[model samples]
Target: MLVHKRVVRLNEKPRIRYGPMLIRDQERIANLNYIYNCNDIEALWMLRMKRAPFARLVQTFRSRGLLQDSIHTSVEEQVAMFLHVVGHNQRLRVVHNTFRRSMETISRYFKQVLYVVGELKGEMFKSPTGRTPTKIRTSPRWYPYFKINNIL
Candidate 1:
């Protein structure tokens, strides 16, 4: 049987440099700006939810013992990572690059947020009361149709 051997390099550290900037520094700067300076429209596009809604979700989960801020990652950042994964159907590597987090960190928090969100599915998807709005019922075009169907 043939055996495969790996060679270890001595006195060498992984080098990640882009021109004059370091990769880690670039990622940190990008993540910081994206997370903090994003407008509501950008936030909605990125997360598939508005800022207020996302904040509400984070607050609810925090209050329910589902999520908390760790030493390195905050609750908001965790939720954003979760959204970036689910909303965009992105892989962990992409999330790592976008969020400036390690793959392990991205995977861990992704699973955690996913579990908590799944547990809170009932509240998240609560059924409507099936009540029609009065404005819609009273509309000229809708009134005749609704009256014919006895819907109103």
Candidate 2:
């Protein structure tokens, strides 16, 4: 009797193609048109500088264990959601529509994100090393008094 063994080979390298699709081409054209035709400085400012607060909040949340890299939502999306809610002061439904998320999904994301932010606040701000300055209390006798008729 003769026995034969089967050997398996794996592809070590894979090839990838890099190019723009039809949809991407159209989007690029539209973006260029907007840049050329739109004179809205406020819109430009909004696109660039408006996300600072959200970025800070997202950083805080990431620092805490409540947020992890394994989550499906990108940090950018979370930050955008946060900014949309804060800048517009909008309701959850509005935020959901703005972020192009379902209301239930948006609610869940906001709930988790806010919970993480709160945890971060407690962990960071509760200590003196945080941004908040230490509170100081003055003695009653040393408190500054206004002089109405030169009376303490």
In candidate 1, list every pair of residues with a backbone clash.
Answer: none
Worst 10 residues of 2 by lDDT: 1-10
Q: TM-score of each candidate?
A: 0.65, 0.43
CA-lDDT, candidates in order: 0.82, 0.53
Best by lDDT: 1
Report the C-alpha lDDT of model 1 over 28-102, residue by residue, as the tens digit.
767756864688898878988888888888899899888999987888989999998889999999989888788
Give the clash total for candidate 1: 0
Clashing pairs in 2: none
Residue runs of model 2 more than 4 Å from their true location after superposition: 1-56, 69-72, 122-152
